[model samples]
Target chain A: MSATRDLVGVAWTGLMARKVRTLLILLGPIIGVASMVGAVGLTESAKGALQVQLATLGTNLIIAQAGGTFGSQNPTLPGDAVRRVDSVSSVTSAAATTNLSGVISVPVQGASTYYEAFPVPVRAADDSLPSVLQVRLIDGRWLDSADRVLHLRSVVLGSGIAKQYGYLPGETRTIRLNNTNFGVVGVLGKVPLDPTLDNAAFVTQWAAQHVFDTNGKPNELYIRTKDGTTAATATVLATAINLGGPDQVSTQVPSNVLAAQAQANKTLQKVALFAGLLVLTVGGLGIANVMSISVIQRSSEIGIRRAVGHSRSKIGAQFLLESLFVGVLGGVLGALIGIAVVYLVSSLEHWVVEIGYGQIPIWMGLALLVSVIAGLYPSIRAARLEPLETLRLG
Target chain B: MSTQDPADPGPSPDPGDPTVQLPTATGLAGPAVQPLLELEGVSRVYGEEVEIYALSDVSLQIMPGEFMSIVGPSGSGKSTMLGLLGVLDLPTSGTVRIAGQDVSALDDPKRSRLRGQSIGFVFQQFHLIPHLSALGNVETALLYRDIRPRERRQRAFEALDQLGLGARADHRPVQMSGGEQQRVALARAIVTEPLMILADEPTGALDSANAAHVLEIFAGLGTPERAVVMVTHDPTVADTALRKVSMRDGRIVADERRVA
Candidate 1:
């Protein structure tokens, strides 16, 4: 133990004797570890945000849309497609909706004489739309089966449209669309995953078929699978709905999209890790170079120690410990700086900062190992020096 | 004390036998008075293609309590002889024995251990680690020993104090004069209480005053269980020893006993 303490003292003194050189040698590893931590933290936070967003969107939901070109002339899903999807064993609920683009006009607030028109996307959805889309009604009740059966001219305005038109729930307003006036019944809050949904208008399927002449067909279908089923159920539903074959319809599962996104993130992380390793390699080389130079400069001191009966291995261990010390110091400083950088970025982006605290040991361990490896050659060189020759040279 | 008297020489003992004891005129005979160091037909050759015999067919012996000096001009292989005696290098074709143990056959680590246990070295240049304190430098001699830190420090302190540098224990080599640095080196050398002390031109860099002081210190370290061997080129320093050996062309030409 005393020998070890003496070795550490001697190594530390050697480093402290040349302050500028030691500091310069330390910079490489410090920068390498700091950037590595920062990159890892940044990637982790992004992945966390993505996971939260996916959870908010509900993983069980899948979207099926008419395949091929999308335009006014393209054929959409038949009216019975929703019924066909609902009949699938794995599907719990399904809703079909057709989108239409039109202009809407409303009287200026507190100035009934003036009118303003804005282009808006309109969605015609069944009574099951709320459950399938997981949308929340902020102002009034959602559409019921009676509203669809009665073919009532009722509409729900998205929050953005409501704010634009100065419309409120229970306040009857005429929304002119395709030369027909529809009465507004409710307004929806912002949807978590789909930002575009906040600018759309919603109406019943019967009203859309009668007023817009959509022929009881829908361009989009939203489905909720049973508790354990996933995108595979979408394939089954697609095959059942599109009796014609695979090319006639398309299916999408949000979880699958998230999986692809996570895969891309993994690739990015691997690249970042490679870059980090490259930087660390440069840092390791710097340590090796410094240790080599130290060995040469301290050759006489080494001879003195050897003459006093220090073994070659002891001399080697002293230099190795010096390099290891530098590496550990760099690791600590880099970790702090990296965490700070992560915090600053997370704060600016309003992301939940996640710095896997468990990885701290691994990072430091890696740094130490790298330093040992870097110091190996130089330490061996120092140990191979002949005490007689060194003393004679001096 | 007696000066040199030409006594009849005894038969040489077999070099390979560890039990053999050679006769000496010191009156302290038997196994207890055995020579502390011995070299038998030692030779050291350097360079591969162009051979150079740094030391050739050299043989010498020093008993306990003996203060001996090896005086030679340059190229007389004094340094090479010192290296072999200190176990810093092995003789190419001969045996070196310290305290009755054959050292040339030992491995590097064992050789180092033997040197640490039995031999102390004082160089001409006072090779003290520049960054370590005087006490720290002295303590380094016992770093590999099985001693505790507190004891190591205490012993090192005592060694420094004995050299009259107790108050300067915390000073670095750069902060001390040449004589003080050499004293610290001496303190380091003696901290282990080795059987033999080897001084290689110890006062080569000192003035006459400092040299005399160092010689006085060396004179005070002689004991029945310990020996001091100094290699020097200065005849004035050589005269301070009780016995002296002059070397020429890697061979001892004169062995004289001035004081006994």
Candidate 2:
């Protein structure tokens, strides 16, 4: 008997019966939100994951003495200060290592003394290197403590290094790192981030020290502070140790690297926030306009209802309900599509995509709010129409 | 509820005894001799660039339960007068009293309510809602009341049954014959049980047979409790009314009684 119920009945009948037109009316926001959600998701994920990728060296690492520029082609982290950091912290684990590329000679059949050889990059770690920079071994054991003192020609070649020398685990092959021969002890799996590391052999500190002939402390220090000590605190501690030391060797809490990473994250998060807001604003306005226009067109139906005893508010509510239906549908669908795209992208590549700690939920909520407001304004307009005028115009 | 009750003597005295009976076709159910509606100086003005007077100073009165007809040429303001009588339109200046209440002074919503409760409308176009069935079109008058859905359908069926249209209840306007559709329209008009039925060219949309059938139904509706007012242009149709009046330029030109 109340005006609104009948209006709702009338609106519901028309909308439900005309399914395609209703969906077409809602299309603008759906497509817009989908594109916006997917793009923003991918960009933020790529930025955040980059920081983690850069910080994989697990130790409190600091470099000095201008070996190379930061985030550059040749040198961000120095290779010589690894030992100095070990002496600074009692529980410290450190190593100095450099990348080398040279051929390793192997005697071939019918060759009396000389042999054909192939070139490869080499890396030498300190005795405590395994403790400082861990390797995920595919096969064979790491170089033992005895391998450092003996100055033995023993080495651990990476998978690429093994492939270059045509060698595998338990096989005999020699690789010359900086013109020094070292026996192949093992092969590691592919670390695509550094092709140089992948192709290089792991040599002991003494062999590398004797070969390179640079006993000048390491180019950088990679130290492990005791647990419960902040990376910043450890860096502070290292700075304190280096400030008064003769070597000018600095200590850094590796956590600053993580902080640097998160700084990038913060900026990316802000960008994602802005993108989401833009989508919501535009999408909301579009939905609101469309809903309002439809309400205007249906004013005659509204008049007919009024003449039949429908109230003004009832007409308004019917329109509002239609708007709300659109909003809820767009929101849930946009979120689901956003998360699905993130998943597909992450799986096919090395990307890290997380929907929970990011703009996805916020955007979805905004979309929902937009949809609600879209319905709300039209509802009010419909409710305010005079039954008398409506009937006349109709 | 027998068709011929044994307790009710059949046309007592058969017009043979002075005090016993009346021999009129609708004897006991016939209309009382009292006016049910009165309009004094009813005028409707239409204003555009220049003000056009649609109806000016129209006055008329209809006795309760009498069959009345209003005939006029095109642009004669007959529709305007009927609109005022039905409370569908307000008089620009004048008084319209229905059942002794000055309805022109009542507020718009109250007037509308009064029309819904007391008057039924039958228009030339059949005016049945296209989406509704014949029965549904008839049932629209009961929507504003608190009657239940099943009861509403029952009453609608009863009205259509009286029009001899019980079989056409499920048909739509397009599906029914012109005669059937108009009979359905007539059924719809009387379904609300209003005090008076107003027809604006009820037979204007129908052929001769359908128009005759609609006229017969209109004639049958004249009784002691309800009255009928129909607007027409045809003399043959106007001749069917118990009383026929003529209008020209919003004023009555003639008023007369049918010879039976």
Candidate 3:
């Protein structure tokens, strides 16, 4: 152990004797490692953010819309489409949704005016609307099958609509759509991702058909698959539904979109990884060049040491240790700088910092390995130096 | 006589002189004291197509307590002889024995160990490591030894003090005068207390006063258990030794013991 420590001390002294050259040699690896770490951190955080956004749109939900001419309004789905999709083996439940523009009146508490009229968007949906859209009810009750059978004029208000009209659960507010009035029975909590749902009122499909003449049709069908159903099953269902309506229906599975996005992100990660390795290879070359010069410059000292009884292997080990020290020092400095860069950029972009701490050891290990490989030739060259020849030159 | 084989082992030409005696196969004519260093018919050749003979048919011996000087002009193979004696290079065809061990048969690492344990060297340039302090430079001599760190430092300090550089122990080579640096190199050389000390122009870079001081130190180092071999071109420096060997064209022409 003492022998090893002595060799390490000698190596350290040799490096300290040439501080400027050492720092200059370290610069290349420092920049390379820093950029590599920073790129990995940035890519990971971006992927995390994308995953969060994808999660907001439930993975199991698939939206099927009527595919019509681009400029024209999308054609509505047949009235029985919801029941037909719900009956599919892979689909757990389905809901049909339609939207109409309407006017609503809310009673004023302290004014002489009897009511105030405001434009409100209205949606027609079934009892399974909350399950299909992943929505929660703040108060009151949703429209059930009995209401549709009885043709009761009942409505549910979104949080935004409720706030705007000062409507509460059990409130007898009438909303007029195409000169027909419906009673509000429930208020929904905010649906952040679906802004249209947050600012609209909802009623049963039967009431919507009777009141607004939708002809028993809906703008879109929302299907929730069984727990184990894959995205391919959703496509199969959409194909079955559009069997007689060619070029008139479109299918969208959020999980499939997310999978495609993840695949592209993987390719991008691989490219970035290749770039980082290329930079590191360049840095390794720089290390090799500097180490070669160091060996040449210190040939006389090596000869002297050999004459003083140090073996050639000891001399080789000393140079190898010096280069290893540079590698470790550069790795440590680069990791800190990379982390700092990652944090700064992430904060600026309001992204969650997602650096993998586990990767740090692996990266440092790789840097050290590269440095050792780079130093091998120089160390061997130093060891092979004939003391007689070197001292003669000196 | 010129065409006769050099390895005939017969009396050399001009054998009438009694002061110079060629070494025989039975080794030096003394049985009581073993020679500290011995080279028998040593020859060193270098290069391929156009071979160069650095040292040819050189045979010599030095017993303990001998202060000998090898004096020669340029290209007389003084450096090559020193390298062979120092175990830094093996002779092309001959035997080198140090303290009765055949060193020419040892491998590189074994030879290094033998050099570390049995020999010390002082170069003409005072080859002290420039970055290390005088004490640190001396300590390097014991680095390959099994000495503890504290003992190594203490011995190095004592060595420096003996060289009259106790106060300059902390000074680096660049901060010291040439003479002081040479003394530091001398201290490094003697720190190991080896069987022999080899000085290659030890005082070549010193002034007359510093040179005298270094020669006094060298003269004082030759105890009954140790020997010293110095190579020099300065006749005045060579005259300080108890015995002198003169070389011409890679062969020793004369070996004379002076009345001290």
What are the per-residue Cα lDDT tens digits for candidate 2 across A182-237?
67776666643334457666776666567766443344444555555535545454
Highest-scoring model, TM-score = 1
Q: What TM-score does prediction 2 earn?
A: 0.68
- TM-score-wise, the better of 1 and 3 is 1
Between the candidate structures 1 and 2, which one is better when assessed by TM-score? 1
Model 2 residue B51 CA deviation (Å) reads 1.2
Per-residue lDDT tens digits for candidate 1, residues B1-260, read: 11212262223332221111222223344675677899999999999899899889888988888998999988888888889889888888888998777887777767777787678889998988887899989988887665556867988999999999999999999999999998998998888777789999999989889999999999888777679999998888988999999988788899999755
Query: Compared with the real two-chain complex, what DockQ does model 1 have?
Result: 0.38
Runs in model 2 with CA error above 4 Å?
A: A33-122, A127-135, A149-151, A157-173, A187-201, A224-231, A240-243, A249-394, B1-38, B61-67, B97-119, B128-196, B208-228, B243-245, B255-260
Comparing 1 and 2 on DockQ, the stronger one:
1
The DockQ leader among the candidates is 1
Fraction of native A-B contacts kept, per candidate: 0.51, 0.00, 0.37
**A16: Cα error in model 1, Å:** 5.1
**Candidate 1 residue lDDT tens string, A1-394:** 7567778877888788788888887876777777778878888876667667677777888788887454546557766888888888888888887876443434333332343244677888788777678878888767777787777787888888888878866786877665567777788877644556688888887777777766767878888987678767877766788877533678887576674564326667678767777878888999999889888988988998888888898889888888888889888987898899989998888877778778766766677778789999999999998988888711
Off by over 4 Å in 3: A53-58, A64-95, A99-211, A223-252, A259-264, A357-362, B1-31, B146-148
**Candidate 3's residue-wise lDDT over A211-259, tens digit each?**
6666767777778887667476666865566557644677777566564
Greater TM-score among 2 and 3 belongs to: 3
- How close is every model to the real structure, measured as TM-score? 0.82, 0.68, 0.76
Candidate 3 — which pairs collide? none
